[model samples]
Structure formats: C-alpha cells, structure tokens
Target: MRKPRRGAVILLIVCLFFLPSCEAIDNDFSIWDKLFNPVWDGDFSSLNYKATYPENNVTSGGNMEAWLDIVGWFNMSRINGTDYIYGDPANQSITEYNAIDTLGWNDNMDWIKHELLYDVVNDTLIVQDNITMLWHHSEEKTTSEGHTYIQKTYYYSYLTVYDSEIIPKQYVYDGQNIEALITFYNNSINPKSVIFIPDKLGLYSIDYTYKNESVHEDLMTGYVENNSKGIEFVNFTYNSGWSDPGGNLSHIGVCAVVKGGNFTPDNLSIDIYTPYEQLNITNYNLSTCNLFKGERSMHILLFPILLIIFSPFLLIYFIYKRAGR
Candidate 1:
C-alpha cells in the first residue's frame, strides 16, 4: 500500500476539524426534532375549566343565560365585524357597528361597546356590554272590553359574559330568553396523533391527520367549524396587530355557545386531544433562509464553509490525475 501524500494528510485533518462527526450529527438531529416536532407530553390538568353564565334579567320579561364546558383547548374569534373603537360608548363608530353586525343580532337592538376582562387568579374571563332595545306591541282589532286596545312594551338591556372560557363572548339582551344552558364537554378519549416528516423541507406538503373524524383540514389549514353540534376544531387566526400573549395557535379543540335558549347536549362527551404541535414556517425568513436572531446561523453557514475549504484539495487531485494520464 502506498503512503498518503502530506497534502492529503493535511486535507484530512482539515476535514476532521470542520466536518461533523457521526455523534454530532445524531445530537443535532435530536435537537432538530425537539425544536420542530415538539411532542405534547405534559400534564394537561390546567386545560379543564367550567364556564357558567347564570340566568338573569337585565329588563322585566327579558332574560339571558349561557354555559360552556372546556376540557382540553379553546380559541377566540377574530374581530372580523368591525374594529373596536375605544371611547365610543354607543358603538356608533363604523367599525364598532360593523363588528356588532357581524354577530347577526336583532337590528332593532342597539349594541353597546363591549370589553373583555380576565381574572388570572380564578382563571375566569368576563365580557361586559351595554345594550338597549325597544319592544312594541299593538292590538289591531277589537280588544277585551269591546274596544280597540294597544299595548307597548319597552326593554332596557345590559349584558355580561361572566366566568367564561371563550374570549369576546357575544351577548344580545334581546329578550329572546334561552330556556336551557348550552354545554360542551371534551373528554380525553384518543391518543394524540403525531406526524413524522423525513425531512424538514417536507413540512410544506405534509398533511396532518386528526383523530376527530369531523376534522377536514390539517393543523395549519386554519379552518373554523361552527355546526349544529356547536363549534369544534376551530382555529382562531388573529388579525394584524393583535397578539395572543398566551402563545396558543388557534383554538384547537371544542367549544359551545348558546345565545339565549336551552341547549341539550346530544353527545355530552367528545375525545378532546391536545393541540397539535407544528413548526411554524413564519418564524424563518424564507427569502434569506435565516432564522430569527441568528439562532440557526451556525447550521446555515456550516455546509458552505465546508465546501469552500475542500475545493482546493479537489482541484489539486484533478490536476495530479491529469498529469499522470
């Protein structure tokens, strides 16, 4: 066997210094999995919450009541109806009115400005509103005493979303009177599903399979489902400038809301799995392939540096072979 040249030995040493060892590669792959494929493996007891809005009358003959039970996850709707205008009491601002209009409440009713309050200690969410409505009734024909009679009724409404799980709950004080409380229960019934992509690049085309047979979209598809069964598998996407300090990606479970009447749960228990974990592509600046704050800069620079360092040795080997030929 011929001895290796001094230049070859030096190049080998350079490769050893720059290239990642097998152990290093394995360690790196594990880190990559942790960052991108974060497993949902922790106690989920914090997810259990019971929301109750007691029945009450803001005005005589007009009552409101609602309740929601959350077991695993929750999400709130984006303010799609109108921009919330602060200091606008009547909610007359075009944006504020539009927001109320989006809820599809009675047009005769006036929407007062709405606000949300959170109690950290109790883990309760409160929604307060000021609403007003005019109720009118008239008898067109003969009345009880052999004479035409007309009766007019007026209702003044005030609403609040007290001790709730969902955010920005809508209350109409429209006197519609809900007879039964709406209830939603998410019982842990199925194992959380995990998808493994062979490469990070494959994430763009990956499709997540949800255990809920009703789910039609992947975790990233951002679909909202509000059906007769109540809202489930809804993803809440916030508008620009809105930030969720809770660090949750869309409400990824089940929820139920009753406007003003009795709701009976046909299926009281559902298999509520933990929210799926995903690698957010927006965190990376795709144009530059640069991770935010240079977190992955070392990984990005490694391959290029290795290529540059080995080019001269490859060129030398080509030239020596040509000369020998």
Candidate 2:
C-alpha cells in the first residue's frame, strides 16, 4: 500500500513536468511546417520606392521611365509612346501613365506621380525598387499661355528584391522579365530533377556538383544586402569586386544575368538545396521535441497505471474512516 501510494505520486509529478514540454513541441512543429512549405502566390511588386522633387509642375516622363527601370516590371513601352524597351513580349502594349502626366498635363493618363513616398513594408511579396531624385534645375519656360517654371529633377533608381516565398525552383532571366526554364538535378536524393527559372538579369549558371555541408550564410547575407542592409549587418566584399574572364563562380544560387557568368543563352538553370548542417540542426531540434513529447505522451498513457496504484490505499483510507465513524 505504501509502495502503491509512492508510485502514484511519482507518476503524477512526472506528468506535470512533461505537459509543458509537450505543448511547446507541438507549437514549434506548427511553425516549422508553416515556414518550410512556402508558397509564392503573393504579389512581388509592392516594395517601396522613394524620390524627392520641387513644387513646380513639370513633365516627368524621364523620371517615370527611370522608376519603371528600377521596378523591373514587364514594361513593353518606354514612358509615353509606342517606342518599346526591355523585353519584347509579343505585341503586348503597356499604356499606363502617371498622375502628373494624366491630370496636370492634359488629364489623359491612368497613373500619377504625386509628392508622396511609396510605402510597401506590409505589402505581400511585392518587390520595390529604390529611387533617388536630385533637384538639378528649375527653369522658367515661356509657353504660349504664360511663363511657367518647370522643375528639372534628376531621378536615379536602384533595384532591390523582396519575396514572399523561398524560391526552391524557378526560372530567372538575364536583362529580361521573362524567366527562362532551367532544371535542377539532385545528385544524391533519388536522382531528382527540378526545373528553375531566373527573375532578373545577372551571371546565371548551374552548380550541380558541389554540395556544401552547411547552410550557406553567404546566400542569406547577399539577400539581406540586396534588400535591407541598413538595418542589418551585411558583408558584400566577395560580391562587389570586378569579375575575372571566366566570371566569379564562388556563390551558388539563382541570380540575374547582368551580374556576370558563363551564360549559355539556353536554359541557364541550377540545382541548390539546404545544406546538411542546416538539416542536421533542424532534425536534432525536432528529435529533441519528439523525445520530450514522447515522454509526455507516456505520462498521459500511464494515468490509468497511476489510478490503479493508488486505488487500494484510497479504498483502505475510506474504509478506515467508515470504521472510525
């Protein structure tokens, strides 16, 4: 009876300790599942672009062109007319004008360039380009109506990337918006093949041979530098230098064609995967959770055992009380 009572107390104490760990394991797995299975269905064009200008009214067709260049959208037309630039998308006419061109000019445009900064922080998967406008000159042009001063603002644009999904497999093109189809060849795991494409232009190539043993910190570092370097610590020493004749091939990931490389003009595909170090860390943590949760589950399963162990003592105690009464 004494042993039974002791066993029951021990089981309950063990279960109490295991419960919190079990709940924590469940929560961690939930978040891991969400993070691993990334979907690219969100928009990638809402990134912010900033530019400064004066208060005078002026034709900003060039500024609009620069902004479009920075955004790197599939722009068929230049700024105002039928003259096409960038990728030739088979007679697809993009005829959207800014607000200043439409409203103040002659009220014949769909979009407008107002004196507002483009904010795209909370926007979903939208890639925004950074724009800088320098007030060069303000000239007074004598038109047929009256003397109107036109503000000359020099616009400079920079391209940055922001994405909603981890691009495990996709096609990215160099100097074009249309991503070319490339395939991934996994040498180790079941001889799997995945098709990838490029999104921007740089030195695009394939690296199917070398498999790193750890999560390539350079990839994350490069991403941070290209997106939000000011808020984060980024080292771009390897990526920012001049390219050799054969082109720099130290990094392994999907990239644009303009950067540099042995671009074959064909599929320009590559195969990349999460490193074993990263996988090991992930699995170790998961295994720890599994063990902890398994102990909790064992405790849950042992509840009847606890009840059985204490049943005789409880029965004796009740009987003793009745006899005393």
Candidate 1 lDDT, 1-325, residue by residue in tens: 9999999999998997666443312222323233333232222222212323222322221333322222212332212221111122222111111112222223233333444333423423333333333333333567678897555444454444433332233312221221222222221221111112112211111222222212212221122332222422232222112112121111233212211212223312122111222222111111111132233334433679999999999999999999999
- Name every residue pair that clashes in candidate 1: 82-99, 178-260, 178-261, 179-261, 179-262, 180-262
TM-score for each predicted model, relative to the true structure: 0.20, 0.16
Point out where model 1 deviates above 4 Å.
1-122, 129-131, 137-163, 166-230, 234-325
**lDDT of candidate model 2 versus the reference:** 0.28
The lDDT values for all models are 0.29, 0.28
RMSD of 2: 24.0
TM-score of candidate 1 to 2 decimals: 0.20
Residues 152-193 of candidate 2 have per-residue lDDT tens digits of 543332222222211111122223233334333222211222
Q: Give me the candidate number with maximum lDDT.
A: 1
